[model samples]
Target: MDAVSEIPDYVKRISFIDSNYNWDNERYGDKLQKWLEASSDNRLFVACYDDANALLDGKPFVSKTGGTWHRTYLMQRYLKKKMKRLSWNKTENDSIIYFTADNRRIQFYSRKNPEQKIYHTILVERNGYIQSVFSGTKYEGMGYQFMGRKVYDMYRQNSGSW
Candidate 1:
């Protein structure tokens, strides 16, 4: 857990598509441009493309609107990259928290002291954000309680962002 904090925050390159057909078919080329331009709140940070190699100097954030197809596209790409990095091991111990964009679920898995492992999943808005100290899976009580409170607390703490 300490390692997670030590790893400096960096901008991430979010792709819009992957070889797998996990996203709905849609070509918003011009519409996408117009939508992004019209909604100032819908802008994505340029630094996001830097990946973990370069730390972002500014705070990170994502803006989303009524574009399911676009989100699905992004998810496919994001998942593909993550999957490659994960080597198809969804249950890998390295991943404690997983934002499964395709399923719209954020899963938190636990690596118990010895050999126990548990997982909990919660739905979240695509571009929504959360700051949390996610409890492990075996402690279902804390996990469930934090599920509701952590998000609210993060929202309250980051009120100015919205």
Candidate 2:
């Protein structure tokens, strides 16, 4: 187990997803760092695409949005470039897919309408964290809970561009 200070403060029992699918260098770096800190990545279990070189080759991302295809062009391109970072594998099983990481096995999923979407959405997450994408100025996120205290997105968030 990591020391409390070493771990990023994740939203317990809840997760948020920002549907924007944004990509900015600083934001990307920040998000990546946070993810590495919170995720189950050690030396052996292996994270899919943390390495920049691997990303250039393009890993496994959703070629198809199993539910709602509401992604912007920028989002699509970003996914193509950094899709592997989002998922551990390309194999599609069901809505909730599990992958083993550093310390434990984690699952990745999204809040999409099965009636509308294809099935799988994006990838990557923690037990108590908010999974958001940068939207240039701010993070556009969606909130979901799988484990501890409920994550309320509206609390720390405010309206308008900062």
Candidate 3:
């Protein structure tokens, strides 16, 4: 099983939008910085899960060992570190935002899930105001229960008519 073929369909669909742009660019950097500064106190939901367990945290979360929980924890840490650095890029319409980082060899159980993959982080600003970050792995699906009704409603509404 080649790695590329093993990637889930959903992951492949989103691969095009993965952060290829240089977030270090001055203009994008400024916009990202401003957004981060304004959103410093806003609520953030970190939802992670796998075949057997799920965890949600207001702050970043990560597991110390390699297991179903490792991906979620790694994602949390990745997002937090990126937020601290303000390392993100905006889409052409400025409606969607993204951040990505190379996993390197820091993954849990490096023997199996080697660190060659890239983690994709996604964020959206609701009603031109509040911003929320979402990260998840390809297998177990992204958990959304942690987001309050208002936020969930906003997400559903903006997401589509469904």
Candidate 4:
């Protein structure tokens, strides 16, 4: 449903007076700088628990937040682990998670589950605020499987790595 709409009047009416923009503008630089400053040992996590939490963190069904703006335990863990690939000492050549400027989306590919074809991604709005995240399926209640196994499987990630 997120993509099936027509642009109103051929131009989308988007408002920028939002807290997500302000929150990102204030912290993105500092967090990015901190990530860049981390040593080879890489102690500080760029998208740390407290850091990656968006302004719409606890909110659901946010318009710009990748559909239902849902958050699952499995999705959160995968996102965190995949985000670590953004740290220094990591080479893009070996990257499974890639950032594309085309539409400002961070595409997460499950290398091992290339056949799963879940189509997961995080959208970084032009404002540089990471707001939306589509974790493969629309809703966990829809029986979305990671690697043919249920998300309830605590070790489902072992079935596929994003």
Every model's TM-score: 0.21, 0.26, 0.21, 0.22
* Per-residue alpha-carbon lDDT of candidate 1 for residues 75-134, written as tens digits (9 for 90 to 100): 434544543432222433442223332122222222221212111122122121222222
Model 4, runs deviating above 4 Å: 1-23, 43-60, 65-97, 100-162
Worst lDDT 10-window in candidate 2: 43-52
Best by the lDDT measure: 2
Of the candidates numbered 2 and 3, which has the greater lDDT value? Answer: 2
Residue range 118-150, candidate 3, lDDT tens digits: 122221212111212222233211433221222
Runs of candidate 3 with Cα error greater than 4 angstroms are 1-17, 41-162
Candidate 4 Cα lDDT to native: 0.26
lDDT of 4 by residue, 1-162 (tens): 124232223321121112221323233434422332343222211111111223343442233333211212123234344456542222134313322211222222212222222122221222112122222123322443222333344533564555
**In model 1, which range of ten residues has the least summed lDDT?**
45-54
Q: Count the backbone clashes (under 3 Å) in each candidate.
A: 1, 17, 1, 0
Writing each residue's lDDT as its tens digit, candidate 2 over 63-149 gives: 343112323223333433453454443324443322322222222332333333222222233323333221111232334433224
Q: Between the candidate structures 1 and 2, which one is better when assessed by lDDT?
A: 2
TM-score for predicted model 2 compared with the true structure: 0.26
Better of 1 and 2 by TM-score: 2
What local lDDT score does residue 119 receive in model 1, on the 0 to 100 scale?
A: 16
Question: What's the residue-level lDDT of 149 in candidate 3?
Answer: 25
